[model samples]
Target: MDAAARARLIRALAGTVIAHADELTGLDQAIGDGDHGLNMKRGFETVLAEADTLAAQPLPAMLAGIGKTLVMRVGGASGPLYGTLFLTLGKTLPEESGMADAAPALEAAVAAVKARGKSDAGQKTMLDVLVPVLEELKAGGEGLPARLAATAHAAAEATVPMRAVRGRASFLGERSVGHMDPGARSSALMVEAVVTWLEEQA
Candidate 1:
């Protein structure tokens, strides 16, 4: 992956968020704060806007702009969590590549997100999807891109059964059992987008 690929991922996520904004909000409305959809939509739009001006910078700089945008614009835990994820990726990523030379940067990002959110897999947070991706990357190393994608998708799917153990959804306790956490859903889609994009490249 390169800058274009990263930008494409953000762009796709933005579009998905917009298209499903109501659904996401509805999902959040059920178990968590009702703002997840709109919040995510706003953050990604900011990312797209910043992407326009970042053509000249390295991919890291471009994504860092997005990280800052989320930190300032998006409200709730997701803002800072995602901000940290992107910022960590930006800080650690190779200058010439994006997710192509991505295993280490992605690992760093998962760690950052976990640290920022104070949650992990089975907690029904973004880390559910993220942790598997990182593990696949670490285990499979550079050749794990496809496996990383698969793991993320599987992890996301797994969240459907697990009750929310952190964040706003946690308040629902047992009621959160059946439904998916909106944040985790969004994270899965984001990773799925990357996987689909990479498969296309192949």
Candidate 2:
């Protein structure tokens, strides 16, 4: 994607996070600390407020800055997990990248998140969404963005049936199975935003 596309994608992701803040919070209220939504909303709001400055920088630089901003502005597990996702990408990706070119960086980011959270796929964490998205991206096909978005949404929904094995929700044991994971939902939201932006580009 180009610089303009990168900025627009980030902004769209932020807006998506804000729009779904209440739902995310409600999900967390059922299984977690109930602060995921507000923390994510606050972090993304900072992204919006700093848009001009962010847009002025190179894409990687801008992403790195936004990651730092999230780490600084948001609290709870989300700030670091999400922040690391972007930070890893910003640091690993080339200055300009297409979906194919970005696969390795995206994979690396996912690995970093898994390591940082000490969790993995099927654990009812953000990995539920991110892993599928990465898999779809790696498995590339026509309309990749739409495919990845669908995978992300499906993975997020799949979390509802999974028993949490990590993080705060794990304490609830089988009780966590019926509730969606806020982090997974938010991760899907970010993927969906990318789909929307990509569609707009077409």
Candidate 3:
């Protein structure tokens, strides 16, 4: 996607996070500190407020700025984890390209997030959703947004049966199994927002 499209996707993602903040907070309450929603909302609101400035930057610069804002404004582990994800993407992405060109950047982002969080897939973390989405992007095909939407949601749902081995939810043991990981849910929502914006572009 182009810069404008990227900006739109970010805006939509901010909206999605805000809209689902309460639900996210509730999910966190079941297994975490119950602040994921508020943290995400505040971070994304700052992103929205800085949208014009961000959109004006080069793609990498814009993404880096977004990551920085989230890191600075958001609370909890999510801030640093998500910040690293986006910052890595900014650093890794190639200039002037499409999803195919974005694949490596996204892949690098997954690794960065994994390292930053010191976590992996099937651990009831955001990686449950992100890893699969990265796979889909790397494969590169038509109806990308549709495929990403499905994969993201499915991965997020799959977290319902997983035991958290990382982050605050890890403290819950079996009790965390049935509850959806708030970070995974929020990751899915962010991906879904990207899909929505891409569909509009098409």
Candidate 4:
């Protein structure tokens, strides 16, 4: 994606989180700290506010700022986990860039989330959506954004039937079986937002 597309994608993420804030809060209430949406909204609000400054910055720089903001502002496990994902990406990404290669960034992001979250595909975490979606992106090559949207949507839907194995949901044991993971749900939304923005860019 180009500089303009990058900016728009980030803004769309921020807006998507804000738009679904209540639903996110509700989802979190089912299996987590109940603040997934709230904290994310706050972090992305900070992201949106800094958009002007970040507009001309490299992708890694923009991600680094977001990571720092989340680490500082958000609370509980989300602050550290999500913070680490973005922070790791910021540290790992290429420097002196032109337009970012979207697929690689998404793949890196999925890896960061998996590493930080410390859970696998069957755990019904964000990995269910992220891992498969990244795989599809890598496999499809072209039409990646559309595939990502389908994958995320499928993963989010799949979460409803699986038991939670990570985070606070693990505490619930069998009770966690029915409810959706807040993080996974929101992660799916994030993927969808990126796909939407990518389509618009196209």
Candidate 5:
């Protein structure tokens, strides 16, 4: 991607998180510490502030830089978990990547997130959305971007019915079932943002 495209992608990612800060916080309030939104917003704001510098780098380096920024700026468990996701993608993806490179890189990233969080799918965590989105990417065919957005939304919604078994929500046990996981919702929003941007480019 060109520097302009990189800048646009960063804006979309950061803007999405910032825009939904209130919604994220609301979700967290139901079963978590209620800071997911603020933390994500803060981290992404920093990312936005550094967009020019980040856009100047190779794609892998840009991603790694964003991950590092998030790890340093975002608060709570989200920092390390989301940081691991991006950092792993940065490590696995080529500087210039194609669709063929994305699935495997994302797979590695998801694995890293799982290891970092000690969680997996069906746990009312971000993994609930990420794993399904990864599967959709692996499936790869027509309308992939739209399919990914749909998959992410559905996966996030699916988390509402699941009892939390990890993270702060785990403390609520069965009480967590009625609420969507904040991390899952935020993850879905980021997926939607990136997918939308990709569709626009196409």
Candidate 6:
């Protein structure tokens, strides 16, 4: 990515999260501490504030820096899980990566997230959205950005019917059903934002 694209991607991701903070908070209020939105917002706001410096770094280094920033700024389980995702991606991806390289990097990142959260796809967490999105990326067909955005949104919605098996929502047991997972929703939002930006660039 060029400097402009890097800056744009950072804005897309962070802006989406910050823009939907209230929605995420509403989702969290159902089964969690109702702070997911606030935490994510704060973290992304910091990211936005540091966008110039982050965009100036090499791709892998930028990702690693973002992960470290998230780990330091964001609170709750999301901080570590999201941090691990980016950190692992930074470790796995080459500085100049192609679409082919992205699948393996994302796969590794997903694994790291699972290990960090001690959870998996069916757990009504961010993994629900991420895992399916990874599958879509691996499939690698035409209109991939649109497909990925669709898959991400659908996967997040799929979490609505599932009872939470991890995180604070798990405490609600059956009551967690019929509500969207805050993490999953947030993940989907970010994915959509990135893909949308990619589509625009293309």
**C-alpha lDDT score of every prediction, in listed order:** 0.78, 0.89, 0.89, 0.79, 0.95, 0.93
Relative to the true structure, candidate 2 reaches a TM of 0.96
Task: Encode model 6's per-residue lDDT on 42-91: one tens digit a residue.
Answer: 99999999998999988788888889989999999999989999889889
Instruction: Give the per-residue lDDT of model 2 (tens digit) for 1-202.
Output: 5668767877898899999999999999999999999999999999988887887777778878889999999899999999899999889888876666678988999999999999999999999899888888898878787788889989999999999999999999999988989999999999899789889988
In Å, residue 44's CA in model 3 sits off its true spot by 0.4
Ranking by lDDT: 5, 6, 3, 2, 4, 1
Question: Across residues 167-187, which tens digit of lDDT does each residue of candidate 5 receive?
Answer: 999999899989999999999
After the best TM-score superposition of candidate 4, give how far the Cα of residue 176 lies from its true spot, in angstroms. 0.7
RMSD of 5: 0.5
> Per-residue alpha-carbon lDDT of model 3 for 53-124, expressed as tens digits?
787777787888889999999999999999998898888876565666677888899999999999999899
Q: What is the TM-score of each candidate against the true structure?
A: 0.87, 0.96, 0.96, 0.89, 0.99, 0.99
Residue ranges of candidate 1 with Cα displaced over 4 Å: 1-7, 98-100, 141-146
Worst 10 residues of 3 by lDDT: 93-102
Give candidate 3's error at residue 26 in angstroms.
0.8
lDDT of 5 at 127: 97
Name the best candidate (by lDDT): 5
- Model 4 lowest lDDT segment of ten: 94-103
Higher TM-score: candidate 1 or 2? 2
- Each model's total of backbone clashes: 1, 0, 0, 0, 0, 0
Q: What is the lDDT of candidate 5?
A: 0.95
The 10 consecutive residues of candidate 2 with the worst lDDT sum are: 93-102
* Residue range 1-202, candidate 4, lDDT tens digits: 4577668867998899889989989988888888888988888888888776776778788778778888887777777777877787677677654324545776777677777777778797877877887778778667777878988888888888788788888898888888877777887898899789768876
Tens-place lDDT per residue, model 1, 40-148, is 8888777677665654467788767778888998888889998898888889887778445677898888888887788877898888888777767667656565676
Candidate 2 residue 136 Cα shift, in angstroms, is: 0.6
